[model samples]
Every structure is written in structure tokens, then in C-alpha cells.
Target: MRRLRIIGIGAGNPDHLTLQAVAALNTLDVVFLPDKGSEKGALRALREEICRRHVTRPDIRMVPLAVPKRAEAGNDYRGAVDDWHAALAEAYERLFRDHLAEGETGGLLVWGDPALYDSTLRIVEAVCARGLALDYDVIPGISSVQALAASHRLVLNGIGESVLVTTGRRLAQEGFPQNAGSVVAMLDGEQAFAAIDPAGLEIWWGAYLGAETEILASGPLAEVSEEIRRRRAEARAAHGWIMDTYLLRRSR
Candidate 1:
């Protein structure tokens, strides 16, 4: 039987690697790195850097995998995602057969916590369902939401108030969550915060968090929304890709 370890490397920072994650890295016979194309080459580079800085073993081999792009948006978004994951499962099976030896351990360094907005676990499940013989374990690390709150120097929730984590599309469509005092939005490419009423709201936004290109903006939503949008656009243009997260709070 083969073993797979899904290690969370934290958000864009080499220091974010936990001691456990480092140990896991050292034990792996092979490490799989996903290439998300030229636009996100920096992401791939970061993973390489982490291995260089932490993996002391000389025998560990690094393997690069081309990540398949999802189909363009249509009426069936879930269906499109299903198709994409299926393709990824096939790719994983081939990689394992080619690179991994029987009874050897392999690893995938996932950004942030694997349990967050990531789909690596789901893809692995799909791979197993498709007949790959493997057992896996998850090692948790800091998430973007945690990084955002830490960078902003604020608590995620008020006294006795709850927080909700959701996507940009839902934020744009649902306005704001009525049940929670704080909302953390991820994977929002459309600047969905712009659609909401800025009055009585505060936002803590960060881009390229924990990296050299990091940017932060906060204050009353009406006062800082335009600046955030402008800065986000500028950063995206400069980097060719951006990963950002924000915390929205209702003023008490």
C-alpha cells in the first residue's frame, strides 16, 4: 500500500511551515507540485523555495504536474467542477504510477489549510474512487483568513458574536449574512464588496498576504472601498495573479 500526505504550507510564507509539516517534507520520497500556468508561476516558485529551505534530505524527488483549467462558466457550475476534478484524478493516477514506487510515501504541499477553500482532498478522494490504492493524512497550517486578521491586528468576531465564511459570489448575491456579525469572503475575483451598502460596515482586506507583494486596506467600507478596488486592480496587473481575503464587520 502507498501513503500520501497532504501538508498545509500556510499562506505564501516559508515561515508558515509548521515543525510537523517540515518533518513530513523530509520523510517524503516524492513531492508533487502543481503548475497553474505562466500567470501563476510565482506560486510554483514559492513551493520550490519551501522545499529548498526546509527539506534537508537529498534523496527526495520533486515532480511537477500541469493543473487542468476549469471550463468557462455555464448554467451548471458544479457539473463543470466535477469534470475538472475527474481530469485531475486521471492526472494524479498517471503521476503516481510513473513516479511513486509501491509502499513509498508521496506528498502534496497545499497552500493554506487543506480543510479551507481548497479542493485537494476532494480530488484525492476522486482519485481513490477511480481505483487508486492509497491512504492519506492531513497536516493543518495557517489559513488566509487567519493571516488577514493577524495582518489587520483585529479580532475576527465581536463579544459573543459569530462569524461566517463564504465566497464572493454568495456575498454579491446575498448582500451580507444576516446571522453573523462578521463575514470572511474568499475566492472573490469580482470585488463583490462593491455591491453591498457600505454604511455601518468595516472591511479589513489583504492581498498577496505574507509575501513581499503584500497589501492591506481597512476602515469604513464607504471610505476605503474605492481604494481597495483600485489597489486590487493595480496589484493584479503587476503580479499577473493575486490571492486575497477580507473580513467584513458590521458596526455596533
Candidate 2:
């Protein structure tokens, strides 16, 4: 019997931390952070900074847990992810039992909102599936998709049209949806938009959304397609890593 509070910490800006997130951080008995095992600890460092700023020895335990790498075992994509989630859940349960008090409050700082493309909620659910009784409270934070739209000063959806939020993989393999407009592509490590016909498509791309090293590019995809690829490579090389999101529109 323990209470888990999963708080969204926004993209990469300290200002993205909501007042509610700060309050939750101040009262938690323990906070679990996932380490990516790379020097690109921007996310982890940001989480640490939030704790350092909001909680002054706030009786909160900070658990830096190492995340297991995704499996490339077979051609079964869904199975690999499923197995990974199961392993992640086991890790969390071990941390909870070792550092958290029974029926006490614990927190997990998730990047962006948990409801978005984040997997923290899935990891938490995995823990619950093991019959570990706990109630979870989620605090919504600004999503990078919102930040991307805001950065470009463009509305995500027009007056009556719809918006499709998708990943780079889908964008690459499935191509643009028939007649769909305003697509937001995220977690695209492979530059999936290259698969689509750049004609009539406009792109708004940003890396490290709100961070100081942020890079923003926008224009006709046909004109800036190669530019974006070059910029993305440069930014990644300069920083040793990068987190980018982009929005593509099929005209107004």
C-alpha cells in the first residue's frame, strides 16, 4: 500500500515545472529518476535541478535508476517493447521496496506529460499488474507538441480541421495519411519525414525545444528538407545528443 505521484517536468526548461509539480516534489518520501547511461543527462539533470530548487532537504529520497536498453532481439517490434516494459517495472518495484515506505508517498518525474508519448505511465502500470496495490496521481505538464506549436506561433489545429500526432516511425512507414493535415512527428530518430513527398508540406522543427541549445527551423519542406537534416546532424554532433520534434502541415 503505497501512493505514487507521477509528475510531468515539462520538456527541458526549468520554467516548465508547474506549481503543482513543485508542491508534489516538496512532499514526496522518494523520487525515482531514470538514467539513460549516457552523457546526455539533460533530462536527469533537469529533474535533479527541480528537486534542488523546490525541496530543501525535503525528506525526499532521490533514486537514480538505470534504464535497460531496448531489445533488438528479433523482428517483433511490439514484443521487444513489451519485454522492456516488464523489465522496467521490475526495476521500479525493487526501488520502491528498497527505498520507499509502505503506504508512503513517492514521486516519478516524467518528461512532458505522462499521457503523451511518454512511457512512465506504462512502467507504473506494469508495477500495478504485479498486484502491488498503489494509487497514482498524475499532474499534467506542457507537452513538447504544444511547445513546438507555440514556438512557431502556429495553432496546432485550424478552425475546423483536425490534427494528427504521430511518431517518426509511422510517419516514415505509413506515409502521410490520406487527406490528413497538420501532423506532429516526435521521437523520430530516423528523420522519418524524408519518406513523405516534401511537396506542399511545410515543416517546423526544433531540437531541445526549450533549452538554451535549441535550434528552430521552418519553411517549405522541399526547400529546407536538406537544411533540416544538416542542422539536425550538426546539433547532434555539437551536443553529443539531441531531442527534436517537428510539425508538418499539408497547407491551409
Candidate 3:
């Protein structure tokens, strides 16, 4: 039986690697790194940096696999996502079937905690569902949510209040959650916060958290909304891609 390790490398920082993740990196016979094309080259570079800094295994191989791009999510959002996952599953099965050998332990480095907004866990599940004889373990890492909070020096919740994690699309549509003490929006490609009512909201926003290129903003949401948008645009233009999340707290 072949074994796989899903290790979270954290939000673009080598220091955020837990001891478990470092150990996992050293134990791998091969680490499968996804090539999401040249646009997000920094992501691949960070994975390599993690291995270079932590893995002491002699002759451990780093294999690059091409990641398929998701098609435009037009109208049928769920269907489009399903199709993308299917394509990724097919790609993964082929990669494992052809590249990985029996009794070999392979590793995959996830950007953030596997349980968070990442699709790697689900994609791996789809590969297993396709009858791939593989068993896996997960190693959690610092998530953007935590990093965002830490960067701004604030806590996610206030005095037993609730926290809501949602996608940007929903936040744009439903507006601020009625009872949620704080709302964190991830996968927010559309800058949904800008479109929503910023009244009574304080936002702590961070991009490239824990990295040298990190940028952070915090203040009344109405006042800094444009600033965050401007920073995001500049960061994206400079980095070719950006991974960011923001926390919105209701003002008391």
C-alpha cells in the first residue's frame, strides 16, 4: 500500500511550519509540488523553500505536477465547481498511478491548513474515491485567518460572541451577518466587502500575511475600504496573484 502525507506549509512563511510538518517533509520519498503556471510561481517557490530549509533526507525527489485551471464559473456555479474537481481528480489519479510506486510515501504541501479554504483535501478524497489504494495523514499549519488576526493584534471573537466564516459571494449578497460577532470572508476574489454596507463595521485585512510582501490595514470599514481595495490591486499587480482574508467585527 502506498502512503501519502498532506502537509500544510502555512501562509507563505517557512517559519510557520510546525515540527510535525517539518518531520513529514523529511520523511517523504517524493514531494509532489503543483505547478499552477508561471503566474503563481511564488507559491511553488515557497514549497521548495520549505523543503530546502527543513528536509534533511538525502536524495528526496521533488516532482512537479501541472495543475489544471478551473473554467469560468458561468451561471451554474455548483456544476462548474464539480466539473473542475472532476478534472483535478482525473489529473491526480494519473499523477499518482504513473509517478508513485507501491510502498512509496509521497508528500503534498498545502498553502494553508488543509481543513480551511483549500480544495486539496477534497481533491485527494476524490482521487481516493476513484479507487486509488492510498492512505493519508494531515498536518495542520497556520491559516490566513489566524495570521490576519495576529497581524492586526486582535482576537476573532468578543466575550463569547460567535464567528462566521463565509465566502465573499455570500457576504456580498446577505450583507453582514445579523448575530455574528466577527465575519471572516475567504476566497474573496470579487472584493465583496466593498459592495456591502460598512456601517458599524471594523475590519482587519491582511494580504500576503507572514511574508516579506505582507500588507495590512485596519480601521472603521467605511474609512479603509478603499485603501484595502487599492492595496489589494497593487499587491496583485506586483505578485501576479494574491491570497488574502479579512475579518469584520461589529462595532459596539
Each prediction's TM-score against the native?
A: 0.97, 0.96, 0.96
Tens-place lDDT per residue, model 2, 74-183, is 77889998998899999888888788778788888888888999888988888988878878999998889878888888888767878899999889998878766678
Model 1 weakest 10-residue run by lDDT? 36-45
lDDT digits (tens) for residues 1-252 of candidate 3: 888999988887788899989888888898998877443677877887888788898889888888898888888988998998999999988988887899999999998789897788899999999999898999999988888988888889898889999999989989998878889999888899999999999898998899998999989999999999998999898877887899998888
- Looking at model 3, residue 105 earns an lDDT score of 92
Off by over 4 Å in 1: 37-39
Summarize candidate 1's per-residue lDDT along 178-214 as a digit string, tens digits.
7888999999988999988888999999998888888
Please report, in order, the local distance difference test score of every candidate based on alpha carbons: 0.90, 0.84, 0.88
Each candidate: RMSD = 1.2, 1.4, 1.3
Candidate 2, clashing residue pairs?
none
Q: Which residue pairs in candidate 3 collide?
A: none
